[model samples]
Target: MNLTLKIWRQKDANAKGGIVTYQLGGVEPDMSFLEMLDVLNQDLIDKGEEPVVFDHDCREGICGTCSLQINGEPHGPDRLITTCQLHMRMFKDGDTIVIEPFRAKAFPVIKDLIVDRSSFERIQQAGGYVSVNTSGNTQDANAILVPKDKADTAFDAATCIGCGACVAACKNASAMLFTSAKVSQLALLPQGEVEADRRVLAMVEQMDKEGFGNCTNTGACEIECPKGISLENIARMNREYLRASTK
Candidate 1:
């Protein structure tokens, strides 16, 4: 396939940025979006022009580092698919593709397409983990069996990959869904009960500190999440936070 890419270019977070257009040809339908960008970059290199900068790791869609706003959609127009999982065939020949980075104050641009997502790390460090000390023959799973329903819910919540697609897709740039997923995952598990109250409070506080907007139930985050995590987790987080803050 042949195409034109209008990609955002910026030297750094402090620099002025604009959309720069380039032509791409001979793209394979099966090639992942990042791979197609690689071909474009190679072409730019051959012409002695600065190549487009983007992020990608573990291109199997596990890392969630492949962030891109393709034609006004996060990770392109695919459902439950990360940018790395997006294929060139999604576009038509001679199409003009608009590519941009995930925009949010919390995610300052580092270069062309990469952003400083350490804010997410800081939020995770706030309370995203269980404080349990497991060693020397940890208790058998059967010793403390949580309800199967609760376990399943917790597992589903735990599937969140922290991709920031939720933020990218939200008009308000909210991280509530992402933070809530982490909160709900632990809040539902027995091992996470010890810090449940404090965990919700801390994570919510950190999320707010990171300048993420509040969730107004527009549901854009759930729609664009590559993991297909639901807005239900956000509701769970709200309930947990309310109960925790009261106590």
Candidate 2:
């Protein structure tokens, strides 16, 4: 298949950027999106042209580093899919694909398709962890014996990969989904109980300090999230924040 790619190119965060066009020929329908990009970059390199730059790691979709806004949709038109997992077959021949980096003031564009998502790391550093002693191995997996329901919920919340798709897809660029997912995962587990209040407050404050926008319940973030992270997590975080604030 052939495709016309209109990709955003910027030298740096402060540099002026614009869409640069390139025509990709002979893209295999089954090729993963990043593989197609590799083909494109190879062609550009052969001609001594600067290759298109994009983020990718563990292309199987676990890393969440392959960030791209394709055809005006975060991670393309697919639901519950990362950019690396996106297949070229989703597009038809002669399609014009508009590619851009994940857009959010907090996530400044570094180059072609890469954005600095270290804001997430900073938020995590703020208090997204527990304080369990690890001097020795625990007794057994069944020792804690949390309710199955809570365990399941916590597992679901833990699936968040910090892709920043939630912020990019939000009208206000809210980091609520990402922050809440981290909170919910630990808050639901028995091990995360001791510092729950402090954790919520610290993470939320860090999120705000990162310049991320507020959540208005537009639900765009959940939809664009490659992991299907739910807005229910946002609601949970809100309740946690409210309770912490009152306390």
Candidate 3:
């Protein structure tokens, strides 16, 4: 298939960026989106031109490193999939694909399609973990009897990959979906009960400090999330926050 790619290009964080168009041919329908980009890069390299830079770690979609905004949608037009998992078949022949990095104040563009999502790491560090007693008297995690429903919900919330698609999708670029998912993952579990209040407070505070906008219940984040993380997590987090604040 012949395709026209209008991709964003920026030399550095402070450099001015714009869309650069390139015509590509012979794109296989079965080729992953990143693989199509690889073909484009190889062609450019053969012609002594600089290749387009994009973020990608595990192309298997487990890692959310391949965050991108395609034609105004995070992770392209697909539902419940990351950029790396997107296929060339999603576009028709002679289509003009607009590819850009995920846009958010907290996710400043680095270069080309790569953005500094380290803000997410900072938020996670604020209180996304539980302290375990690793001394000689450590309790077995398997010994804890967790209710099946709560366990399922916790597992669902834990699937968030920190891709920032939630932020990008929000009109206000809110990180509430991602932040709430993190909080719910721990707040629902017995092991996480010890510091549940502190965890929610710290994470939420860090999320605000990172310049993320407030969530207005638009539900865009959950619609764009690759993991299908639910808005219910956000409600659960609000309840947790209220409970924590009251205590």
Candidate number of the best TM-score? 3
Q: Per-residue CA lDDT of candidate 1, range 1-247, in tens? A: 9999999999887999999998888999999899999999999999999999999989888887889999998899999999999998888999999999999999999999998888889999999998755777677756777998999999988888888999999998999999999998888989899999989999999999999887889999999999989899999998999999898
Give each model a TM-score. 0.97, 0.97, 0.98
lDDT of 2 at 168: 86
Rank order (by lDDT, best first): 3, 2, 1
Mind giving the per-residue lDDT tens digits that candidate 2 earns over 115-231? 999999999999999886667965565788899899999999999999998988888989999999999999999888899999999999999999999999999988999999889
Off by over 4 Å in 2: 137-141
Which ranges in model 3 have alpha carbons more than 4 Å from their true place?
none
Total clashes for model 3 = 0
Better of 1 and 3 by TM-score: 3
Candidate 3, residues 1-247: lDDT per residue as tens digits?
9999999999999999999999999999999999999999999999999999999999988988898899999999999999999998899999999999988889999899999999999999999999998888999888999999999999999999998999999999999999999999999999999999999999999999999999899999999999999999999888988998998
For all candidates, the clash counts are 0, 0, 0
lDDT of 2 at 143: 83
What TM-score, to 2 decimals, does candidate 2 have? 0.97
Candidate 1: segments with Cα more than 4 A from true spot: 134-137
**Model 3 Cα RMSD, 1 decimal:** 0.8
